[model samples]
Target: MRKNSIKNTRINGEVQKELSTIIRNEIKDPRIHPMTSVMAVEVAPDLKTCRAYISVLGEKEAKEATIKGLNSAEGYIRRQLARNLNLRNTPEIRFILDESIEYGVNMSKLIDDVTKKDSNSHRQDEEQDEN
Candidate 1:
């Protein structure tokens, strides 16, 4: 299957859904953070390999532990995937830590702070002009 094809997209979505479900409900690993989520999934065109982007809402240690937990359970996760979906080949799963969501949140906060300060400065300038 060609990359970005309809079939590939569908497969990626399916994998992402299943991965989230498995991690959220099935896995009992203590190292896996409860706030962990599957951010995205990219399955190769041949379906031989997959990259799972995972987001954890916590500190650096939590993110690292979550990834470690997921990596340790790769075999079980793959088996679960095969049972849940009828694919020609179950892709080898690789867990990647994704910080985009957290980064975006931080960036938003920074922007808001800047805008607030800018407005406050404008108010001060107006008061000085009036004086």
Candidate 2:
């Protein structure tokens, strides 16, 4: 029952930033579209594995291709991390599509539509109340 300290937050943020930059600059895979971005990284408590959530703005085929490309280059990515990060053991990286952003966008659109409908209904009620 302990809170995450500022130092821990900073460390996690640093790791995410490093991973994003490394993937963007170092990993040169044709299958990974330019629209793809590393959104976040969650490292396990023991630091043995890290789940990298990525957001790709493209068709389903493009997303699958990008994920496959990243999975295949996992070994090379781990080696690069070893050279850059001073860790006793580099964690294995797993790529996952971060759908939260997409979900948020969809939710926002739905909310807007609902709001408009409510406003129209309210106006009709007001007109009826006036009559």
Candidate 3:
């Protein structure tokens, strides 16, 4: 059961794919990190605005630079998108930093640390009990 309309979903997928390609191959701004990716795209129902979630695999400064670069190139991106896709009006692109991947990685590391500590404590408890 999907909440979005079929048209919206299709548009979202197309926009995501096209944007990823554009960012990776077309945009040549040095400020844009090579490790940047279009994680997701959300287009408004009216198809006038689009929010692109970008994930950059780098330091804070690199991420900020990448976002700034992308924002500056929004018009170019929109033109490219319009050329590639036959949409009547290309949505106004907005770049947003997506940190879910980094958050997940940090959370995983924390869980692993806790698990290791628990195992070590259990081992010590077993040794004390045998003594």
Q: How accurate is candidate 3 locally (lDDT)?
A: 0.94
Candidate 1 TM-score, C-alpha based: 0.99
Query: Could you tell me how far off, in angstroms, the CA of residue 66 lies in candidate 3 after the best superposition?
Result: 0.3
Q: For residues 32-78, write the lDDT of model 1, one tens digit per residue.
A: 99999999999999999999999999999999999999999999999
Model 2: per-residue lDDT, tens digit, 1-131? 11265644554566777777777888899998788788877776566888889898888899899999889988988888888777766888899998788889999999999999999999999999999
- Model 2 residue 16 lDDT? 78
* TM-score leaderboard ranking: 1, 3, 2
Q: Estimate each model's TM-score.
A: 0.99, 0.82, 0.96
Top candidate when judged by lDDT against the true structure? 1
CA lDDT of each prediction against the hidden true structure: 0.98, 0.81, 0.94
Of models 1 and 2, which has the larger TM-score? 1
Pairs that collide, model 1: none
Local accuracy of candidate 3 as per-residue lDDT tens digits, 1-131 = 13398988999999999999999999999999999989889998877999999999999999999999999999999999999999877999999999999999999999999999999999999999999
Model 1 per-residue lDDT at 68: 97
Clashing residue pairs in candidate 2, if any? none
